[model samples]
Target: MRLSSFFMPTLKETPTEAQIVSHRLMLRAGMIRQTSAGIYAWLPLGYRVLRKIEQIVREEQDAAGAQELLMPTIQSAELWRESGRYDDYGKEMLRITDRHDREMLFGPTNEEMITDIFRSFVKSYRQLPLNLYHIQWKFRDEIRPRFGVMRGREFLMKDAYSFDIDAAGARRSYQKMFLAYLRTFARIGLKAIPMRADTGPIGGDLSHEFIILAETGESGVFCHKDWMNLDVLKDAPGMEDDLQPFFDRITSIYAATDEKHDPANSPVPESDLVSARGIEVGHIFNFGTKYSKPMNAVVAGPNGESVPVEMGSYGIGVSRLMGAIIEASHDDNGIIWPDAVAPFNVGLINLKSGDAETDRVCAELYAKLEAAGLEVAYDDRDERPGAKFADMDLIGVPWQLVVGPRGLKNGVVELKRRATGEKEELPVEAALAKLLG
Candidate 1:
């Protein structure tokens, strides 16, 4: 992609309404534009990052043995009514009426809808351990939507619903999703700590929220200091393997959101406790028969008895992760995107755009990088060197390749790593090799 043809409308000053660094940076970087009170239009750069995040979540869900499917944003109100949550869901639910005057809603979640789908076709215990998931847009008219996408009225989410025949099967499904969440966040360069959390309206007896510690986070969390050093991905259990031991190892540690924290009853000593503000990135629930029982989503058991399938729902805030990642990874300049979620792998800058030698060198490097399966954003515009550097940094590409007449004359170019601010002057070939490696 060439900057000359790119539609990034970067701003020089921060918007007053943006209270958080992620919101401000996203606006100035031209990644997203607010189209309404709480809704946003993700621009080209933002959409790329969003899709990358979505794909990571999708891959992790697949690895956990969940099948993918699409669900509609609008749902029949009758489903929610059957689940006894239409009115209980409160003002957040966007109730609607169709042309035929039938009740409908822009679904905030899909538990009711998914239950209906399950009971429609799945009739026996043979399809017991099925998990279905989808990545889709959702709306929940937040009364006070703020902090950009972090608390937006509309957002993208990856929600997976699990159906099992009994409590034991449901627990296994929950453990699988817990492990999947850990791996998903790690792949996105985040160390998300799983903490006991309230199930809220989802009405689950067992629930966990995966949170990333950040100074700008909205909620306070307490956990054992050892959580900082534990890497859940170090020895991941197989999908079909019994995961109780793995689950026990993680949940044994003391970790909780403020609502669940009890200092006096905590097992970990106060000296070993770490308190910090954290942003929630993912949540998983083992709801037993919460949705299935209420909606009469039953299947025949092995004994030929009708039974409500045990169910669990797992959610990862696909769009909110953009803000959470920025909160955890950015510096004073702008966002410091992780390599896995960066929109482009490299930013190629022709410091002297019109200079024949500099342009030739940058063009060659860009082509070589692309050929090596890298995504490159070439700044071919006639802009000042400082302006080009600032824009590239703001957009947060993992690497920046600088080419200038002086560097070209010396048969070398500059390669800079965005995260570490490390720079090396090397031959074009050497730079390409380093980047590829």
Candidate 2:
């Protein structure tokens, strides 16, 4: 994509409402725009990042033997009523009434709806262990929405519901999701610690919130300092199999969020305890028959008796991750996007857009990078070199290739790594190879 043709509205100064670095940088970088208190309109660049996050979520879910499906954003309130959670769900639920006075709501979560779907078809124990997932928009209507997408009212979440006929089986399903969450966060360049969390409105006896350490985080957390050294991706397998050992390896650690933290009973010694702020990015829950019993999500058992399906729900904050990634990866210049989720692989800067030699080199390099199956953004505007360089760095596209009169005269171009700000002067061919390869 060419910058001149793109819809990025780069800002000269930070927006006043943006209190956090991620929020401020996102606005200045023209990634998203605020629509309501917590709602945002994701622009082209923002959408690209969101889609990359969705892709990673899909890959991890698929690898964990879960099937993906699309669920509607708006759902009937009748389902929630049947589950006995209509009034139980507080103000966050955005309730509405259509012309006929039938109540509806933008789904905050999908426990009731997913339960209805499961009970409709699978009546036998043969289909007992099914995990269904969807990546969809949700509205929670936060009263004081702040921190941009991090605590947004309307956001994207990857929620997976698992059904099993027995308690032991349900626990195994929870472990499967536990392992998947570790792999998912690791892929996106975050070391999310799974700490026990209050189920709150989700209403599950068992829950874990995957929190990432960030200075602007909402909740306080306490854990063993060793959590910083545990490498999830380093030990994950390439393909799915029995994940018992993987699950065991992570669950062996001691971690807890503020709600669950108890210093007296904690495993970590006082000196090793690391107390800090953290952003909750994912959650896993084992709710037993909370939704199943209320909604009659029952299945025939091996003994020929009908029983409420033991259940679990898992969630990953899909949109909020854009903010989390920035919080975890950014430096003073701007957001340092992870290579896996970067909007573009390379930023091709034409130091002098109207200069024939510079334009020629940039155009050729841009085409070559695109041909190599990379997402490349070319700054082909008749803008000053400083402005072009600043915009490219602010957007954090992994790499930047500067084709200027100086480099052209020397048969070289300047390549800069967005994450490290490390520049290398190399022949155009060498730079292209390093970028594309």
Best candidate (score: lDDT): 1
The per-model lDDT (C-alpha) reads 0.93, 0.89
- Across 238-309, the per-residue lDDT of candidate 2 in tens digits comes to 434566777667766777778778778877688888888889899999989989887888988999999999
For candidate 1, the per-residue lDDT at 122 reads 97
Off by over 4 Å in 1: none
lDDT of 2 at 129: 93
Q: Using TM-score as the measure, which candidate wins?
A: 1
TM-score of every candidate? 0.99, 0.97
Model 2 poorest 10 in a row by lDDT:
233-242
- How many residue pairs clash in each candidate at the backbone level? 0, 0
Candidate 2 Cα misplacement greater than 4 A, ranges? 233-242
